[model samples]
Target: MTALKRRGTFAYFLVLVTMLLVWPMGVILMWAYTPWSKSVKVAITICLTILTVLTVHSVCYFRIMPS
Candidate 1:
């Protein structure tokens, strides 16, 4: 008898929660612990990087502009 491996919902939930609480650590956890494929991980990393860059750029631009 062969038993299939299943990742629990709690683990996924934890990842999401951790991401909300501490993004950098959560990203590290996602890479280190999760069984997700490399392509998925790379896609997520790219998305996060783009989002971070956009957010910082927007904040900086807004802060510098006159009212």
Candidate 2:
């Protein structure tokens, strides 16, 4: 494959990895939130939200970036 194709492929893989990795963390955060301190739960929720946003952004960025 050409370098551009390789870069695109790598970008896709990174997005996949980010999604896979964040999903479990998000699940765990959801599970851990119940009965916990509001502050802690809110923090985890915020972190999970940010990860989800980043995952989506990376996927879109990879798809549109010249490669």
TM-scores for all predictions: 0.80, 0.51
> Candidate 2 on 1-67: residue-level lDDT in tens?
8998887677656544543676664445445433457786677567777977998999999999998
lDDT of 1 at 16: 74
Instruction: Name the best candidate (by lDDT).
Output: 1
- Candidate 1 lDDT trough over 10 residues, lowest sum: 1-10
| Runs of candidate 1 exceeding 4 Å displacement | 1-7
TM-score of 1: 0.80
* Clash count in backbone of candidate 1: 0
After superposing candidate 2 on the true structure, give the runs of residues whose Cα lies further than 4 Å from its correct spot. Answer: 1-33
RMSD of each: 3.4, 16.0
